[model samples]
Target: MAVNLDKPQRWKEDVARSVDMYNQWFLNFAPGAFRATRISATVSVEASLLATSYLRDIRPETMKKNPSILSMLRMATCPPIAVDRLIGLAGVNSSLVKAMEKDNRLPVRVTGDLLDKELQKIGEIIERMADPDIFVWLARGDEPRQEEIHRAATIVADRLCGAQANPIIRNEQEKRQLAKIKTWLEARGYNEAETKARVDFQNMEPGTFSFRLNVKVRDNTVNIPVDAVIMPITANKGDLPVLIEAKSAGDFTNTNKRRKEEATKMAQLKQSYGDNVNFVLFLCGYFDSGYLGYEAAEGIDWIWEHRIDDMAELGL
Candidate 1:
């Protein structure tokens, strides 16, 4: 599909309109929107019940078998330093730590007496969780005490539901974007099989060279995965072999560094592939005001900017 050069300006205008609308809503009615509702109403009651039952028996064995229980508790606790210490003290498997690291959810690092103090706090919380009085209050829906229990239960339920639902949501979104891009390309006479989704550069060119962008390690090279790639039909095809990198950022506050890193990657890709390959960066969802300018300055070949719902109109 051809790049829509005018779309980025249109997207900026759309973003401004959305921001104005959200600002108006927030000023008028967004605050205290859910203050009147109970925490239990915000989450599944059945899931909270299940979590309560599981939390009652939170031994090392049970924790290892049901890591989600620990995950929920960790989510409920502020900072979660105590939870991390407790997990380490409980001697849970290395997989939990690895998963935490992968998700960027690892708690603060502490050692010696400080860690012991945190563990003590975590143990007290665990004791409270296991107490029969709390469970009784939770079951009876008692006021005040029940509110505390309900808040904890809702936190667990929210974390568990998010863990289960986020992957499905992201995958569906990726698939939808891919389908739209593929259809747009096919309409313009590109072969269906030529456009592939989830293409890893390692599979395409293994060990020939590494594309390092803002990466700090010498031997820790990773394969960059393109969301969608259009392969060249012939060796002399000048207009083919386009690499598309699509990213949807749900929040812009924490995305500045990531977007800069992406710009570095785009520059690195252009440097590595030179004029033989084309690189397109497709951005959707939230972005900072200066993001497009930064991407352009980084030497990206093309950028198709639109909202998440406007993916079909990206390259039209």
Candidate 2:
């Protein structure tokens, strides 16, 4: 059955409701809650061994004075020196002093006035392997353990440096939006089973279906995964599946690129599915003029999470 597209007023209301729900949830979001979960997993023994070996001889007094180098050492995820490479540079089984380069781990360059340049180089190398942020923990005068260094390194690498650091928050938002969409679909006579959290069509004929929609971003085409979909248990010869893409964002800035990306994805899906599929963009927050432009340009049918009453217009 063909879907309805004439309920503009209802669509607006749905959008407003969805935005309100998102705003309410965002207000209570605690970033620290996510940060607290960072150390749930333990670091590998190999990594700990490497970290311990690197920091063995560094004096606590020197580490405190130049904490930046200590911080780098604590955060280093991988061994800076490959065993083979180290052996080549300092001779096989050489002392730690010969292994660290003179300028390797020191925050400031060591002058010729300093005696025993090799030992200073070793100290600097140890400092380079540790993360600076852990210096506060070290300031307590507790001897650094290999596992502690490894854990701090993991936090720095995965939480501080990684994109999507707090995925739990994003995931919760997606789940909320998906639940809202599923509720709307069920109220409009779509079977609860038909509206699912994740939908995959892997074994379908090669050219006839795609699990992901691709969009051109800069010089590359990026694939956006469809969060959910509604498929009839038994399809009439001309009946098409309804594709749902749900997005939740705090504000326009965070969603601009995503909004455009989704629009591009919708355009591609429409081209591929033609009359055989329907598309709905379920947005769970506020959008600005730029978002509206992309939505209009793509000719996408969208509904706000709050104003979900428009689902009735689908006439399923």
Name the weakest run of 10 consecutive residues (lDDT summed) in model 1. 207-216
Backbone clashes (count) for model 2: 22
lDDT of candidate 2 over 1-316, digit per residue (tens): 3222344445455556656787677767535435444443223322433444434546534433443332234334234444345435434333332323233343234323342453354455545454445433444555666566665556554533233443666776776667776665556455543233333442222112222333222334544466655554344445555566776766668777777676666666656555344677767776655565566556666656666675555433
Measured by TM-score, how close is model 2 to the native structure? 0.54
What is the Cα root-mean-square deviation between model 1 and the actual structure?
9.0
Query: Stretches of candidate 1 above 4 Å error?
Result: 1-53, 76-125, 129-155, 159-175, 186-221, 232-240, 250-255, 305-316
Per-residue lDDT tens digits for candidate 1, residues 183-243, read 6555655554323343334233211111111221224353455666654333232333456
Which one wins on lDDT?
Answer: 2
Q: What is the C-alpha lDDT of each candidate?
A: 0.47, 0.50
